[model samples]
Target: MNHAVEPIELARDCEAIAIPGGETVTLPKGTAAFLTQSLGGS
Candidate 1:
């Protein structure tokens, strides 16, 4: 469950899939991502 707001900053370019279309995309460095939950080996 999400309790605290997790703030993450990308250290380098990372390839990720676009959720809606499932398209492969690259997340540039310094990008921000918030994690509410983590599962598996993420």
Candidate 2:
């Protein structure tokens, strides 16, 4: 017997998750600043 690792595209195709309505969610200034710092300004 053999097994193969699935590609990311395949995995994403098989999975589903819910997203909120708005394109962007408003967060408090403090929270936004913290996230920006954590993500290195993305």
Candidate 3:
């Protein structure tokens, strides 16, 4: 016997979010500036 499976499709408006360590924060437009000021740029 043979079996077939259908592929799943994702919606266009779908979005993903990561919540690591249970801390939620927002980064402003000046993200590079903030990082440089705090941890220095790479």
List, residue by residue over 1-42, the lDDT tens digit for candidate 3: 223354334323333333456555444432331111125454
Which is the winner by lDDT between candidate 2 and candidate 3? 3
What's the C-alpha lDDT at position 34 in model 3? 12
lDDT per residue (tens digit) for residues 1-42 in model 1? 564476699899988888679999999999987655556773
State which candidate, 1 or 2, has the greater lDDT: 1
lDDT of 2 at 11: 18
Per-model RMSD to reference: 4.2, 16.9, 18.4
Extract clashing residue pairs from model 3. Answer: none
Which 10 successive residues of model 1 have the least lDDT summed?
Answer: 33-42
Ranking by TM-score: 1, 3, 2
Per-candidate local distance difference test: 0.79, 0.28, 0.34
Q: Worst 10-residue stretch by lDDT in candidate 3?
A: 29-38
TM-scores for all predictions: 0.64, 0.18, 0.23
